[model samples]
Target: SRAINADTGVNKQLTQMILKWRRPGQELLVGKPEYKSVIEASLGIPCRHDELVMEVMWGMKRFMPSLVRREKSELPKEDLLPVSQGLQMLLSSYGFDVKPEMVNDQIVATASVLFDCDAAEKKQYRDFHALGRHLKNVSGIEYENWDLLKLATAFKIITSFLQ
Candidate 1:
């Protein structure tokens, strides 16, 4: 008796056949009767409809992202107001008086340091105040009076939860 398992050669061949028949350029919908008939004839065995559908869906899910072009959408300032307001409230609760408008700048600076900066630059800004000064110069945002230590602490607390 043949051992039936997902890693079998027959399964690999079936996957390859399904992928080729449903190539993205062909734009053929999955689970079509004609597709099942073709697969049955090619393999000289019965093709279960549910199994074929599952294989086709899996193939599309795996490959569609690379084949499709996605547009970047920018959020308007008004949409970010709630986020700024929430940040302001959180800071105020921690006894830091921060303006809501400054919250946006703070978020941008934090993201820039975390994602855009090189490892050396990130190390250079290890001190919260140093990070604030560097970001202020780069973004032209005034950070002279803001409490960098408190803001950094808040970011640490929030990011810890995310991680």
Candidate 2:
């Protein structure tokens, strides 16, 4: 969880992507009102923001099993970075001494100065997108196919314990 090299090209792209995706008028956030129900028709199950985040994180975790584990004192559960401080602690435990990356990158750091992180549904979508990118980058997985969904769900179940 070292500080992301903000000056790096990858970080710069990530920043821009996060910003663009978060802007008020973005298509993902402002889905066509009439098309939404149509899109949701087959799924039937309503998609909750927290559930989506859990799913994406779950998928990411499956590709990196060593990063999580369960405590014997309780029923098997995920042991993830529960809060900002916990994230830092996890980094320190891993021998990283630099500024810790935000546990909630989708929550944003650089642009928080210009935008509210808790304003609307868009926030969750943006965060989930950011997290999915971060997981894809950091987990080093070439995830493909429908199985990816299972991978994500598994990670969520484990990580929920730290919540």
Best by TM-score: 1
Which ranges of candidate 1 are over 4 A from the true structure? 1-71, 84-86, 108-163
By TM-score, how accurate is candidate 1? Answer: 0.21
Q: How many backbone clashes does candidate 1 have?
A: 0
Candidate 1 residue 74 Cα shift, in angstroms, is 0.7
Deviation from native of the Cα of residue 144 in model 2, angstroms: 11
Best by lDDT: 1
Candidate 1, residues 101-122, lDDT tens digits: the string is 5546455345335444445444
Cα error of candidate 2 at position 63, Å:
52
- What lDDT, from 0 to 1, does candidate 2 have? 0.41
Steric clash pairs (candidate 2): 58-152, 58-155, 58-156, 59-151, 59-152, 78-158
- Which residue pairs in candidate 1 have backbone atoms (N, alpha carbon, C) closer than 3 angstroms, thus clashing? none
Error of 2 at 19 (Å): 42
